[model samples]
Target: MAADLEQPVAGALPVKRTFLLIGTIVIAEPLAATILFPFIYMMISDFGTVQERYVGFWAGLITSAFFVPQMLMATLLGMISDRLGRKPVLIIGLLGSALCVFLFGLSRSLSWAILSRALCGLFNANAGVSRTAIGELAHNRGLNQGRAFSLFGFCNSIGYVIGPLIGGYLAKPAQKFSWIQSGNLFDQYPYLLPCVVSSLYSIIVSVIAILLLDETNQGISYPTLTGSTVSEETPSEALAEQDPLLTRLKVAAARIGPRNSTWYCIIGVGCVSLHAIIFDEIYPIFAASAGDHGLQFTSKDIATSLSVMGPIIFVAQLVLYPFLNDRFSSLGLWRTSAAVLAVVYPLFSLLPHISENHQGSSRIVQWVILLVLLAIRFTANVVAYTSISVLLNQVVAPEKRGTIMGLGQTAISLGRAFGPALGGTIWSWSLGNGLPPPFDFHLLYVIELLLALAQVISSLGLAKSQSVYL
Candidate 1:
């Protein structure tokens, strides 16, 4: 019994509790999002009275709104965690997230939904704080950094897998639940069930964290680098006296210099994220619209098509990425991924065109083309997701990981917010006043090409800059 007590807790945690916490946070939001995604078009049709063409556009805004505040405040939240502790941030984020989920169920108007989404985005930095806490824990246990990140990725991937599947299955039943029916009982109330589930998950995690989680940030009192001329209190003492949350945020942000490799890496990450946003925002709409021309598929078919890419991504991260990272420079991976993405968008544009023009070709040819496009898109996703996060990890120090990740999250959020609006406007324009078949495809290809160019420019810029790690 004494020997059991004497054994360190770290070994036990990675096997059980740590993974559970990470898995809960990762899976809950995505599961909720997935449930809503399949139903989004239905809700927009019922509630917003919008056309099918605009479903993706409006859905993008709503989804992006949920992440905007997270992106905007991610750096600040991370910095705060660095100063005072990760536990408080984790608690606050989970609690706030749950409230936001509840409000989402309660929202009566589109405007109310938007407001609630923004608020949820504001405190959604729980993921970053979790990463920082885990990183610190890993460091203390003498675990490898890459492996730590991979473990975190694995937890999130599991969530990604379960979230969509559950969401698709639960969409209709959630609407009929008694409480949701009594309130607004609209056609889309089914989405409320997933939100309820997510909120409960958050509350449960918060309770568990409050009891079991410790202050893993152990180096808060390291002297500031601004030459001991000023008499600032030690970080630990300051944390003790102040509203530790806000004070720590301010101090950590102040310490982070603008011109460091970390900032450059963040900029690069933001640029890469922009293309991802645009592609993701645009693709579903494009796929759905294919129904109008020659391609036949429902919105659910589109969801399943995209969902197939998730496992492809998992395989790359698990089997392909480490080998690629070892054999080639991170920059090499970035360049290769960008090149493939740049070429593939134009090919995607050709799919519908071939469907219309190929008189002699069998139906199998078109399906084959679509399948190939999905494959290319899947490969692009694998490369981007794995490579960017890995490179970002290498550029920043462990102390600054949370803040930097917050900034990266913010960029992604901004992309989500704006990308759809931009794509919708373009799509709306291309479909304008009776434009012929393939016009939307042409417009999308043009936008994707521009994004590809932007990625290339950013990659070149990254190459020229001195490697922070090397």
Candidate 2:
């Protein structure tokens, strides 16, 4: 399979089409996941399940709920895709996410809402499956894998942009728009519209996948000399079953690839994911909180700020990333981006202070500063995410791509799951304790900076040991 993948393809046109299909399908999960961010604080508050002071904690829990099950299931799902083929797992994940989104919007209580989000996470193995498919497709077709993954990141930025818009604007339609009067579905279920829209988008993408997407697992396509099809596991399973315990361990280790490089890449991905998710989960809660500690922004304001990230990330991933990748290579770009994030994250803590001190005409200046900082943060995010993903694909063996990608996704899911719960807990503790400057709201940012710095250290290690692959 590895030798076959090295051969050149006839043209780029078909490869482009496959990338498009995979990219489009990959958008649904992120869209469904992020659509709740704009309105989630309000949603938790409306549930009346906890004191206003503790809202951040519950909000964080809800945010983390979507990732917890994903962390547990991603590796298994990836391994399943290795056996069952990628298309089926991808479609099932999409459909499950769509159903869960609708259920989440209809949830009237906090427990139900968390359950809905958790189920959504359970259904989403799309991230790993899509990455594996794209990696395989790019390698077999002789396409630039870096460019293909960057395009995947571009589609994700689009979803991030659109999801918040839907959540921000459509969340309380009855209150926002005069036509959406009281006593109707929109009024009764205030957050339902955004979920419906997000769910429908996923369904549309699933339909497209069913019609146009082809199976990229080459093992499934080839026939053996005896006219039976070869499976990804046939050789490995046979060896593991027949060998002694020591040899079985060797087989397992080989399946995981070069341990030092592979584990370093996974850790790098996890750290970046942790800091990114903490920012996403905390930003809105911080913006909505009252007094001097927060920006005290409404859902629309938070949404507007987040919406700006889409264009910045879109341009960064599609235009700037490819150029940077060419000049710096994936590891270099990853290191630089991680260093930028370390610098950029701490700046966010200054925004509330800036808004507090600045007033009237200076309000415009505050908004500008806020947007600029967000732009920088998101751009670094796109570069780091795309580069790390490309490196992950490069480090794994061809037959083990599915399982390895799944493990990578598992690392990301674990970071995402832990980040929100930790951020929310810290935010709530800071507010409740009435602590000093650095220990107060600034604490989360400090932790974020540390995570980014850790990523930089990991990148340095990879640079010394793994640059040969680049």
Candidate 3:
């Protein structure tokens, strides 16, 4: 971590290996984040402590536990990364996440599970630092900033694809898979198999990062976008000359330094994160809930669909996202995707209706519709997140990149902290209380659509330029 080198110009950059390393970082966090989603409610159920009617409430809180500490500590870690360098922070976050998530899997009760998740969130600042590292790495390579960030987004899509497979298939190995069920730790902990697998992968990746990853901080930050070199004085001076609104944002992020485009990107990510989390928390609960209330799916059934969907999302990102940055403004592309999501959420809400109205049709038909709608919705959201991440790195100088990106993660994490809890309670209330049509599980999607529209509107306030930093 302490190894240092003079900042390299474009031709001297380590393109392939650096991408591989950061790509692992990008995928590992989400892998850990989502691997538990398929079975978390079931884990809580196994505790047998929460009543059936309120399981939704507890499940949401358990999921939210990971993000709450992440929200609180992201910026602090980012600052730490800036001072100490990205490699050490990355190692700490990766190893810490592995330990914490492994602890959660070994937990005997809900309280222990929640504590494990919270500690995991507190220590895993990998998302922010990884972005920080990618931004600097790509910048040093004189690459299209969008291309580097797009690759990370693509890896994220891969994570979504793989995480659920591990969660769905590997969890409860004692019950789901035979062979050594009698002797394995999974027989005792039940959920430990997947966590153990994910933790081992994380530990392996951390060791690779420790050995191969280089420190990006040179104690100086370069300010340029789209490979256009410029003077360091260009950014703050450009903001000071803009209208009063820009000045206000500058003041808001002044403590962190160089807030203009970065702040806009963070606001955009926050809106998307809020909508994304509601989907994350609400979907599985709605799917796994019993009776005629929802899909009434088993954990394996949910995993089956996700394993299918994750690959589709990955291919779509690979095929479609590469063309985006070249053709559209970052904010424009993001807002357009957000608008598409606004439209798709309603389609997502139509699934239960299809089930009720067409009882004689193949159940496969409903699953197809659900998969299509989810693919569209998640793909759009992923594009928005990736594009916004690129915009964040572009708008901020390299020196402050880690801190600002951490702040961005903090903002998104803050939205997510409320998301699981609020979405869980709402879904629980809808299920338990039989709220009217819109207020039912259907209402969660509706609110998300509305938030997407608002995100579109808020994005209009951002600079519409292709590249803003220089």
Candidate 4:
């Protein structure tokens, strides 16, 4: 082990600009959503009048639509990055994303909204590119790979925290402008302000990236474990001679077969996406409904809850996760936390029913239940996500990092896309005559149970799979 540690690992080409490139992209992509989400329901409601119960479905789609295209395109983007240095690809993706944000501001119909978001997905390769770029940059700079990944996660959490605050406050005009009525401007032009802000941010960040970010795909030159040296005659030729391991991994992941890491990750992330769809996509609807049971919450209140959630998540990632990971393996953390969610998510589904059924009781009961639900879900999320991230960092080889990371990103996007639709469909189904109060409770419970089972399976599979550890 000591000899292996002494062995000179592949050295990455030092690039200071890589940090700016990574940080800017890391901050921009999530900012697009955080700023836009506060007014998503308003956008949907503005587009069309939705039934009270089905509102969750509409809100859920806002998230799902944005992610689906990214999910579909991640592998291709990863492959492209490997072939054509990361900078050009990053520029194209960011430019496309900026265009999408502008288009989202201009969208006047639901179809247009969907189209714009899908386009954003297609171009939103920032996360994947940054991950690949940073990994190479880190290796070149002689930085620890796990630490590099942790830095990305840390920056992401910070973005998540700040973005929502910007959305919650900055996106909204105080008392409306001179020509616009107090609330009419924001209500009528739901995505207008936020989207514009997002576009400008993307453009600025992209410019910085273009000027500063250097290409790391100079021909590979490194000593292998077997004493063989790897290199390319020219940087251009490097693409054609990429390690076979990356190719095999991509082939394995992209296959329709259910046994690969892609499938497990897809299923795992899909389960998590469903809850996000429920909590984020559905919660606003429930918040709106709070008045019937006297829990009255405005859009601002909902925004506040979301904003708080982001920071809390950031703290968990930064302060709590390292300690937790020290005690529990990623798979162990995933299984244990998922088991908690299996129980907690369904109980959460019952809150609205309690509010509706016990109308004469104090509304504090419902509020307490809501808070507890949020706490449990958030805790589970912190534990499960950090574990997965650490595992992703540990599992694959440096050469295949780009493709593997993209695979995970793609799975997340796909899950995020479909999750809302599933939540909405279930919510819609449960609102009918023969069902129990808060009709969707059973569906939420069932989905979570299925997810827990999949988590267990994934844990076992991951434990058996081979990995490279530093």
Candidate 5:
């Protein structure tokens, strides 16, 4: 057992190349999941499954299938990742995912699409595995795990943004492009192009991963038992501090949750993750909905909003996340992010109201405000997510990192699973409730706002738990 404590030095790890490779691999899973967002309603409508009134609920179900496996099997995969090498599991997951995306794009019925998506979910374990691998690498190299995981989160946001961008443009490509061969496969299956593109990337990533990913897991023999553990503060960084803001955080956070420990950080992560995913899945649907009860946004509008959000979020993750984490407690970052969302969601709900009885410059002003708020919201999400991930990884022992982080992944998957499914059902209900113009969608935002506040309360509980302030 003591021999297991001795780890090989990271002297020849090719850290930079490994960073790029793992980041790419992690991006593919999310890209596949998110690429379906913009065209989901259209796909369901074409399937002729249920009434138009239930499109939101059903679209959400298809999306939820991607997460269902994570909730059920992430921990198992993570444990397997510990026994096997991270590289093989990663490669297999990516290759399997590519096939799933292609099948999903080609599905002629809702049942087929659902099965393809669930298969995609069941096959991929990159999210949990990557976190485990990154945590292992950082421990070996004595790197600040926060900055490393921030890059992982940065890669994550890129996938979310680009997936939607591709889905918006490449979906229904036969009509979008005039030069395409008419009456061919593209015309027959309009949404297949984006799926094909995503699948190709997955294939390429799988090949690169085979050539590049080092075996980060040392596979220590656990003959008796295994348990989760939180890594202690390294000599380079101290959890205890004398900063005024941290001091304020200590006092203000006196009643939030339990002490900042393994599962405690996971709880905070679970809440924030749920919030981010709900926004990701619901935004596209809301934007593409008809104006009667929905946001009345066109595909172009949805695309443009995401386009603006992409660079801002990317830059913030690259620049602002590390900068802010250096200055604030984890609880501090969580509270601030939740507070921002609480404000932004209410204003977002106001857009429908702004459209009615407003014209020209007034309408334009509302649009500009919405974009600015959205940008702020995106920045907050990146910061909070990166912060919590860093904390979650920090709270586990290096040897058991895979299983513990996998458990964390399962909790997060529950959020991802619940977010879209519930959001979609409620959205369908809201829009079809026969309420006035803004009231229907307005209810959705109100619910989001309250959840956002729950995040704030959660941070407070964590603070009061007297957890490690980092």
Candidate 6:
């Protein structure tokens, strides 16, 4: 472990092709996930399965369904990738998620939508696998891990931008555009267009991954009890064959790393992810709501607001992050971002109040304020996620990278699983109960602020405990 900590940073040749392939694969999950954001409210309404007041609840449930199974499966999948290799696991996840996306698009009922999303989450283990692959590929080549991960972040930023555009414009195509008659596949299934596009993107990426992506876990070795190095193939395979379940569980539990630092890092990332997801699930709903509390925006308006995040994130991740990563510790950067998020989260609740204060044409001022706040939040989130990823990857050994990354994903998935459901439930209750100020709609952002502060505290703990690594 000490030797692992002292490993020198390598300045080897770039693995552009491999990074490119991984980035392409990495973008697919976010693309598929965010595609539902813009139209989810309307889609739930179309089902007529719940009352208008409870649409938020059902929408939140469908969103949460995707993460519930993902949380359960992430660590297992990560462990599997460590044994079987990253490429196969990634391709399988991509293809499985693609099929689920199609099913989600075709869903006419809440049950089908929830089931499709759950299955999608169950199959989509690419999040951890791809991160593991990037870490391994960079470590193997002594390449700049920061740059590689930044590219990963860059791809995610693009997906976040493009996914909303696709969902906002392509959804309900028969109603939005007119060249065809009313009795078509798109007309019959209004949300199918974006899903088809998202699914096809995944299928194409999966095919590309099969053809081009190389396995990073191949040649990696681990230490045995007798101090001999065992090849990747023999140890895990032998252990699994010897004791299928218990040994693997024991090994996984053992490799989770120092509880103080490793778990802090995991918890820190999880907290940030929880608030970010809650914001993602609630923002559009808040904006589209018809009452004085909302922005009264359409799906297109929501999409446009979200689309602006792409370029902001692109600039932040590609340009600002590299500079900051070069100057400060990843832990330091993460801590700063968390502090900023603590300030930003509560500000979102103020948007409606800001708009309410201003009347008529001056309302444009509120839009400006909204975009500025979003830009800051998105920037902070990009910094936090990218920095924590680098920190998590650095904290573990190369051989256990997959498991650690998977554990990290598990933390994130757990937060996402509950963020939407909790956010939606609270939002509905706040509105329906006629709660007073601070207890009303503001309640959600207050919770988000608390999480951000917790993230800040955890980052401080991580810094103190892992000072040498930082």
In lDDT terms, which candidate is top? 2
| Model 4's TM-score against the true structure | 0.77
Cα RMSD for candidates in order: 8.1, 6.0, 6.0, 6.5, 6.4, 7.0
TM-score of each: 0.75, 0.90, 0.87, 0.77, 0.87, 0.88
Of candidates 6 and 3, the better by TM-score = 6
Candidate 6, lDDT over the whole model: 0.81
Candidate 4: lDDT over CA atoms?
Answer: 0.61
lDDT against the true structure, each candidate: 0.60, 0.82, 0.75, 0.61, 0.75, 0.81
- lDDT per residue (tens digit) for residues 353-465 in model 1: 66664345744586677777766765665566556665565455555667776676666566656765666566656665366645644766767777876777777766666
Global fold similarity of model 5 (TM-score): 0.87
Writing each residue's lDDT as its tens digit, candidate 5 over 1-470 gives 11222333323255766777888988897899899888887888888767877988888888889898867888888888888868888898899999999999997788998899999888765688888887776655556656788778888888888888888888888878986678879888888999999999999989878876677764532221123122233311222231243334335345443234666667777787677787788888876776644456656567777878888977898788877777876567878888898888867766666666446776687678879988998888887777777766655655578988888888788888888888888888987788874557777778788788877776776555555344
lDDT digits (tens) for residues 1-470 of candidate 3: 01122334442335667778888987887787778888888888889888887888898898789899999988988899888888888888889989998998898888898899899888765688888888876655445666677778888777766777788788788776767458677788888888888899889999998888766654433334333343344543443453343444345445444444556678888988888888877777777875555676788888887777776677656667766666877777888998999999766666765675434564678888888887887788778988888767756755677889899999888888888898888777776566677777677778888989878976876654323322
Positional deviation of residue 183's Cα in model 5 after best superposition, in angstroms: 1.3
Compared with the true structure, what per-residue lDDT tens digits does model 6 show for residues 39-97? 99999999977898888888889999999999999999999888888888999999998
- Tell me how many clashing residue pairs each candidate has: 7, 0, 0, 3, 12, 0
Kindly report which residue stretches of model 1 are placed more than 4 angstroms away from their true locations once superposed. 1-20, 29-35, 51-53, 105-108, 134-143, 154-164, 173-188, 211-215, 220-260, 290-296, 353-372, 433-439, 467-470
Write one digit per residue (lDDT tens) for candidate 2, span 108-196: 99989999999999997569888898887765554566787887788777786778778988998998999987899989999999999
**Candidate 2 TM-score, C-alpha based:** 0.90
Residue pairs whose backbone atoms clash in candidate 1: 31-163, 35-167, 70-121, 71-410, 174-190, 175-189, 175-190
lDDT of 4 by residue, 206-253 (tens): 898788766765432233212223343322123214444334433443
Leading candidate by TM-score:
2
Give candidate 4 regions above 4 Å deviation: 1-20, 49-54, 137-146, 158-188, 216-271, 290-296, 353-372, 437-442, 466-470
Worst 10 residues of 5 by lDDT: 222-231
Greater-lDDT candidate between 3 and 4: 3
